[model samples]
Target: MIEVAGDSSRDGDWALVRLRVEGDRILEADADGLGARLGGLSLLEAAAVPGEPLAVDALANALGPIFRARRDSGRVAVAMSGGVDSAVALLRSGPKAIGVTLRLWLDPSGPSAERACCSPEAVLAARRTCHSLGLPHVTLDLRESFRRAVVEPFVRGYGRGETPNPCMRCNGSFRFGQLLDFARRAGADRLATGHYARIVERHGRLLLARAADAGKDQSYMLARLDPRRLRQIEFPLGDQSKERTRAEARAAGLEAAGRADSQEACFLAGDDLRAFLVRRGLAGESGAVVDDEGRELGRHDGFWQFTPGQRRGLGVATGTPLYALRTEPRANRVVVGPREALARRRVRASGRLFAPVERAEVKLRYRSPAVPARVEPASRGFVLHLDQPAYGVAAGQAAVLYEDDAVVGAGIISSSSAT
Candidate 1:
């Protein structure tokens, strides 16, 4: 027999559950905490349990090992974010589906902490949705791992004078990695999600493609996912529009049907990047905003606060408007110049390509349009030779290459030039 414990605390109420198990059966169970609802009885009845806030904590912490020995090929594990899209995905996953949610780290002091997708409120909402559908729900408390994998890199990237896209890193590496592992341990053969992107086969290799709804396509954010793992994953909402997802949720009477979409950089918990960085020890230090000629134009708080192509916040007045060209973190300086100076015809990136291609359309930023580019192989990554000058190509941001609507490759922009 092995011992496992789980606990959940909110406001002031709390619950703790301890269980002694052998294989798939619970031999002994005990509960202790500050609440009357604290107990292990629900956990003993099933390998995965659906419950309130406290029960969710107990089961999420203790149920991993108990379900590891069972393998059910028909079971599908759906990733729920306590949103309408995920709820609709769960509804379409059929009866042999299990719901799973990841409880990630978020700033507790943030005003919008409750609105984060992985907040404690979201975890309970996910659990409630599963219970209402008579399906088991599991929560994986991955706050530490998420911080280590996604959050730290974000902070470091900014310190290096780069604008990092945390969502890309989270989706491409951190989030799916943990979810797939949990699915395997929970005896599920496939992990399904509500992502608005599709997986397609090209030359016998799986590649991510844009969703049917162009406005909601997330292929760029997910471009870093290894195609080899695509076989074990499913995107239930890839072909449907966001409207259809909300409609399905409403038809099923799901509480999240009309819920607003979660915001980006969820760990920030709705706080602005500047405030979040300050809290993370990236305090603002006085720096000089200089012109391309090395002449100081204005004063600023920190060089890390600016990125390439930023137009506002320079606090500089001139005959013509000046834009931020680049940041020199070590020098504590921000370089400002004319808008034309921000243009770049060449972008060097460090990453991988799923398919070999000589030419493709490249997306420099999330909302930016894909521009035509010639692909060149590099030592550690690929280079994009833009047919026309692309402005504001920031370092550390993803340069995703696409063939038609499918993402063929992606890399982080290391540097850019006009040549």
Candidate 2:
């Protein structure tokens, strides 16, 4: 027999539940604290009790360890984001499915914090959906870990004058790592999500491939996922379109059927990136905008505000138009030049390749088209030699390499050269 206790406090309401269990049954159950309602019943029976918000919150928070000993091979854990896509994913996961959500950190001052996928509102929505479907739900509070793994690097990257993609970083490492760990603790063998990417086996190795809906393919964003873990991950909407997901949700009367999609940088909570950065203590000092020939063009608030390929807000007037070519944070200077000057034939990146390849198509940005490139192995990473001079390649962005529709490798752009 083992004894376990769980407690939760919210908005001045608190509850504590202690359970003594042997195998899958709770032998002795005791509940105390304000707003708790587990009296005169087995704690195992209380697990399914309804209409008691405080009791549900305390029990759901404690279910992770209580279910850890029983390894149910057929059980699956669904990652819920309180949206139509994830709602449909849970429905398709069959009856033996459990819903899980990660409570991540968001800017408290942002106006749209409630719209973020990891906000308290989203958590309640997910719990409600699971209960509506007669399924159990779990919430993992991972704000500190998320701030460390994804938010810190994003701020530091921008401080160094690099346009970092925090979504890619979170999806690739932090999010899946936590979800899979939760699945294991919940005695689930598989983890399913609403990602619109498919997994395919190539030469006995799994690789992420583009989804059937070309316009919504997210393989590039998920390219950094460890290929070995693919066997345990499932994408229920991999072959379907976003419209189909919404239709299924509507048919099932799910509340998230018409909910808008979450924003890219969820932590920003719908605030402008510049404003968010400033709020995070990344306020910049006045700097100079200069041309390639070392002539000062104008003055700007900060060099970090500009990124490669940016054309507007330079605050400079010349005979010809100028684009931001690069930012030197050390010198506090923004370098401007002609559009042709942004062309680059070589890119150096720091990451790993899941498969061996000599030639592949590289996507420098999320919305940009893939360009054919020759891959050359480097000291700690790899170099992409473009067939044609690609323009506006920037440092700190992901360079995802693909062979046809399958992702072969991905890396963070460290530098680029004309070569």
Judged by TM-score, which candidate is best? 1
Q: In candidate 1, which residue ranges exceed 4 Å CA deviation?
A: 31-52, 64-69
Tens-digit per-residue lDDT, 268-350, candidate 1: 76688898888887969998999988999899998898988898899899999899999998899999999999999999999
lDDT of 2 by residue, 1-419 (tens): 78887777778988877777676666666764323355444423344455556766677666544555357798899999888888999999988788888989987776767778998788878877888887777778888889999999999999999999998899889999989988887788999998899998885688999999988888988988888889999998999999998999999999889888876678987688888888888876888999998899899897888999999999999999899999989899999999999999999999988889999999999999999999998877899999998878989999999998899999999999999
Candidate models: Cα lDDT each = 0.84, 0.84
lDDT value, residue 380 of candidate 1: 92
Off by over 4 Å in 2: 1-49, 62-69
Cα distance off (Å), candidate 1, residue 282: 1.2
Instruction: Show the colliding residue pairs in model 2.
Output: none
- TM-score of every prediction relative to native: 0.94, 0.92
Candidate 1 Cα RMSD after full superposition onto the native fold (Å): 2.5
